[model samples]
Target: MEDERLYAWGNPWFRWSVVSFVVLTVLSFLVGFVVLPSVQRDYTAGGIWASICRAAGLPANWGAGTATDKAGPLSTSVVLAPAMALPGSSDAVGRGATIALQQCSMCHGVQGMSEANAPNLAGQYPEVVIKQLEDYKHGHRIHSFMEALSSNLSDRDIADIAAYYDSVPKARTAPARYSESSAPALVRVGDPLRNIAPCIGCHGGTDHKLGAP
Candidate 1:
């Protein structure tokens, strides 16, 4: 009976099951202990993922994390100044209003509100607007129309325009359909499997990007 029991334990199915279990355990250990941590680290700003995105011709910083070091020299020189740097004087606002009417009102509304194609500029931070204009002018950020328009603008003109837009109050709209409580997981953590980072990580609130309002 003892011999029979030992033979049963050494059966082909039993042996295979043991081997399979050992292999699975090792694989799980390797994935959980080694692979996961490495992946997490790479998700940080200026990490492996950022490098890969740059190599693939994508924006390395999608408003989250530090920008890649490969940016132009102008980026370093463009100080993140306060929005209030350009005071909303009547003269400056008047000049900006004239410029906006002539060059911008077609896409952006007269009040800096958005149209079908363009974004609303009202209540935008002056610093953010200035940086974007500079980036457009220097070819650091690319938009055919904006580049052409900004190319001819002097720093004072840029500041005036930014101030005018920043001074405008944003119009209130209906609340978004998806509340934070309804989409907590998607809003906060995001889906790692799909490579989607958290929306709030870059847009607003905590962990917002540099130069973002």
Candidate 2:
């Protein structure tokens, strides 16, 4: 008689326990990626999260790379100078362009072409912009000047910075028209990169991602 009573209680407890476990699991997933604050905001945000998930032996979400995050940077007008040769005829009008020069060019390069190690800031999508700034602020992007430069910038400032650079045109790489007659062009490929490897091949364009802009 006692065993029969215990079995009935165990059946109800097991069912309720299973339901609670499923609910908690769903809640945890929502908090981690969707409804929670841990969502990252960059091209690599998904990668970073996946790395974390894999470490814990979980399957990663496949739809990560393309989820553009454009939540943080508020739209605000920032002054900017002319982009070197953006397709458009003019740079941002008024003090905004000048302010961009004053605040940004020290490292990002002149019109986004500086010799510094920093990545060029022109023509990137706004989602990319917000991610980069967030990384800089949160210490994910490591650099000496990054903290100082990104620090104290308001949301509007971040948006303006992104907008200002996006307007700049690609840099000029072609030689002047006068050089067309006499200038010589060479297409020989370089030696293989520092590795014990096969001869590198080049059909067109530079081996490196480098070129005019």
Candidate 2 lDDT over 142-175, as tens digits, reads 6667777788777656656666666766454443
Q: What are the runs in model 2 whose C-alpha is more than 4 Å off?
A: 1-96, 172-213
Alpha-carbon lDDT of model 2: 0.53
lDDT digits (tens) for residues 169-194 of candidate 1: 86665433446677677677788999
Give the runs in model 1 whose Cα sits over 4 Å from its true position.
Answer: 1-77, 83-86, 179-213
Give the 10-residue window scoring lowest on summed lDDT in candidate 1. 204-213
State the displacement of the C-alpha of residue 20, model 2, in Å, after optimal TM-score superposition.
Answer: 62
**Candidate 1 to truth, TM:** 0.52
What TM-score, computed on C-alpha atoms, does each candidate reach? 0.52, 0.37
RMSD to the native, candidate 1? 11.8
